[model samples]
Target: MNDPKLTPQALWHCALGLLSRRDHSRLELSQKLRQRQFDVELIEQALDKLEQQQWLSDHRFAVVQVRQHIFKKHGPLRIRMELKRKGVNEAYIEQALAEEDPDWFELALVCYQSRFRNRDIPDIKEKAKRMRYLQSRGFNSDQIRYALEAEQD
Candidate 1:
């Protein structure tokens, strides 16, 4: 190899250092190792070892991500898209969502309220604009409807 950092020990050292900072998905670790010019085979071995040792888990990553998004009041739809982009498994995503989010309607209302606090429902144009904004935030039509209805109270 052109660089001593390309060695298997060096690769493991680098991977462990990355993991010590925080959890990462397999794909994320692979991408980071590739960026550092580590051998693909070595990267695979490192990932496999990490998984066997329970250091890297898509499940754990998905759970933390879901909790963070829920705390931020982001809708499930947006969270799903983001986790999918990170290559998380669909099953894990669903599991995480089920464990973390109890009601999308409540989350949608919080998100809407945070953005449009104390503002009346206004005219048709403003209502439509609000609808579109919630949609962009990953709320389904039903959740948006419930949120808007609750706001009218």
Candidate 2:
């Protein structure tokens, strides 16, 4: 079997196709290109071109990712970890999170309510389980407390 030849144009096209589908951090895009067996130099050149044209940006990617994860009911902690995994810089991640300005307590409450709409007030064991669930969803202790206390309000 013959391996396909990778060209600069081909790399650019592939990057563009991925970007068209969703915002990708620079590192994510590079990893995808590398996985497809593209040359390092070609991938760099194509990414640079995309950056120059403003078609690719880690800041934009981080912002979009934060919003998407928030919509999915993930807390800022989880979102920040995800962004870090995607290779976004700390500054961009902080900027994006700050700009979004999500009310963590309110968001946690909504997420908790939606997840346990039909369940009765949790007993001690059940409360522990629910607390673990919310924590895994990236909420802090205070946010989780606020969410679990909704019944008392």
Cα-based lDDT for every prediction = 0.90, 0.90
Q: Local error of candidate 1 at 112, Å?
A: 0.9
User: Which ranges of candidate 1 are over 4 A from the true structure?
Assistant: none
Q: How many residue pairs clash in all the candidates, one count each? A: 0, 0
TM-score (all chains, Cα) for each model: 0.93, 0.93
Model 1 residue pairs with clashes: none
Q: lDDT per residue, candidate 2, 1-153, as tens digits?
A: 134557776778899999999989999999999999999988888899899999999999999999999999999889999999999999999999999989999999889988887556657888898889999999999999999887557
TM-score of 1: 0.93
Q: How accurate is candidate 2 locally (lDDT)?
A: 0.90
Candidate number achieving the greatest TM-score relative to the actual structure: 1
Model 1 poorest 10 in a row by lDDT = 113-122
User: How well does candidate 1 score on lDDT at residue 28?
Assistant: 88
